[model samples]
Target: MNPSDAYLAHMDAIVREKVRSIESARAPEQEHYLGQAELWQRVADHVERYRDELSFIVRDLHANPELAFEETRSAEVLATTLERQGFVVKRGAHSLPTALRAEWQSVDFDPRRHRTIAVLAEYDALPGIGHACGHNIIAAAGVGGFLGAAGIGSGKIVFLGTPAEEGHTGKEYMIRAGMLDDIDAAVMVHPFNYDLSAHTWIGRRTLKVVFKGIAAHASMQPYMGRNALDAANLVYQGIGLLRQQMPPSDRIHAVIDEGGHRASIIPERAEMSIYVRSLYVDTLMDLSTRIDDILTGAALMAGVEVERSWDTHPMSLPVRNNTTLADRWAQTQAARGREVLPFGVLPDSQAASTDFGNVSQLVPGIHPTIKVAPPGVALHTKEFADYAATDAAVTAAIDAAVGLGQVIVDTLCDDHLMNKARSEFENAGGPIRATDLR
Candidate 1:
């Protein structure tokens, strides 16, 4: 049964009261090398000048939605747009055909001393709900931010087009391909129900299990058959029961891909696909061990041979949002009249996973969210998809561009801020390799 209307209303009222009572704290005071007011004005001017073009990019990507690594035309459009702004654009970058790398640097740029900030973009859509996660807005905002930051011509800026975020870790792939080797920091904005500077995006790993057993006729000599389907069913039920013992941040779900061919005969083979998620890396690893035990126990109980496959693609680590950069992002958004909430203002129950988590482990980064829809409109839905193309989304995209651009400028120009960010990253167990987690 669905939640009662009265219950939902009461919860909404409570949420509203909480939101009203909480005031987002401002970032600590810090002076930048460049004049903040002048740089911010320049960023805002760029957004105003290219507002229409940014909107066009958003609508075009929304109209021509592509899935995962198949975003060929989408990559081309973004690369060409960046090229028009005098950036050196490379399509098919970082070992992915749909990925792009566009860069602009000052005359005196140096990889050894000068900092390089990457503005990440994800443009992949879901299977049936295209742009429902607001990747089109992400692409536009990233392009706009890169362009605005490039106009300053004080430091290096890279606009990275990362694909396959819907169900694949394209950013992780790019990272493995040395995408962040020389990059100092990264920033990106996601379209969400609220402007949040640091939200929980947990780790996720996929598991595939196949069971093989002896088959026999259901009506005749059924006792001789070892049903793989039964094992699969047990695994599902075991996971359901395991949920009660799991941490609130931990999530596990599975689907049986092959249960049986017919109800009459005992199934000889069964297959299941599962997803395990958690907010912490250690917790995710621990949960993975427990899940493996469950799969093994199910196979043993049914006397079926089982084969397991982990991470059909790449696994996504929980995002470690860089507060140093996030605070600057929040301040930038504040200048644009958007109160970017610090972490914990909203409930973490709405948390999801992102490939950028892997990117954060490699370099200091911030993945803030720009509000494009109402509070109740969840992502990955038709309602959110509809909102992703609205005027509100366009405005939010512009604001995100301005905010990201300012953050990049601040990181590049302010040596103190960058050092603090790097120190913070080191203090939080710096430079984790995603593969090592496995």
Candidate 2:
């Protein structure tokens, strides 16, 4: 059988079994959970039903891996599709070039939207490896989650198309704009090689520093040249020594983009890209600020003027995984027999930073990595890129959509569950966004 045919065959069994479970159970949480489970089975069936059409979406993303905040085509396509699906869509909600929100109203101007939920989709691709992180799948899964709850009886569903997760941390901008102003809770699942939870993400910042010196003939008047390259070298060495005193969790990495034009000349300018990270944003900034001291001191010693230009991505607070939400989410997912992980094995445990951390700081959120590839395979590789369209990944995507949708729906339906989540959120001692961290 062809790959598509084989995939559909396997998918059919998974969905059938899931539907059977749904038919057996009879509670709202169960019926709702099962009903939602059955919904995902339909999504899997829908994928098979629209394989060709959806493949176009994935292929388009693979073909053009745009940077964060610069995803013109991808955002437009996602927005247009959601609009057609009966959502009231807003483009550039946060004034971010690539940020948009698609809303579906059920109660009509809900004063108590009282409960609002967000299903997030990340669309930015790696600089060189297009969709290497499986964002195409992420985008589609976001759509699936939104579709799963397209017309729920109560509350509102917000499908957020966030651009620049790779670097822009677009979600932070959205949060700042009150894009999630009234949102009660948020949940997002990432494509991973395994199913796990209780992940941690470090805070991150971006730096661009430039050095300037008098240009002159290298051999003819070498004595007159200040040697910007040498000065930059000194700065790096200073940065390297500083690392020894920093906490082991801190990461300070920089690269020289230019040295001298040639041995025959003293380069007038040189630039470098710097990335600094730590488990906490406070530590990240403290570490990054130290690097500046080295740069300035080195330039003074070398008699070459130094110019520092830094563009830090949002200061991401450490990920605060909601223990209560996670425990309940796990139990609900486990009831389906898929074996949700035993917490603390997040995919990309080594990943330095993420905007999800920022969101968790603002409001309660889950950034769990769901199983999408073979256990041994690594992410950000060509092999994982191919798996983005795999049968296993697709099923997991549908399951995640249903699972997350149920979590939100469950939270919204229960006054107690909602309050419990909030109580736990405030207790975590995270960012409140107003006065806590300025």
Per-model TM-score versus the true fold? 0.93, 0.79
lDDT of 1: 0.87
Residue-level lDDT of model 2, residues 296-331, one tens digit each, is 898888778888766556655556666556655664
Instruction: Write candidate 1's Cα lDDT for 1-438 as tens digits.
Output: 331232243345435434533443543544466587788788889878889889998899999999999999888889888777767788888989999998888888877878899999999999888999999999999999988877684678988999999889999889888899889999999999999888889889999999999899999889999999999999999999988877776789899999889998999999999999987666677788889999999999999999999999889998888877887888888778887776768776898999999998888999999999999999999999999999998999999999988898888788888999999899778988779976
Report clash pairs, candidate 1. Answer: none
At residue 65, candidate 1 shows an lDDT of: 93
Compared to the true structure, candidate 1 yields what TM-score? 0.93
> For model 2, what is the alpha-carbon lDDT of residue 210?
83
The residue pairs in collision within model 2 are: 27-31, 28-32, 68-164, 197-344
Candidate 1 residue spans exceeding 4 A from truth: 1-34
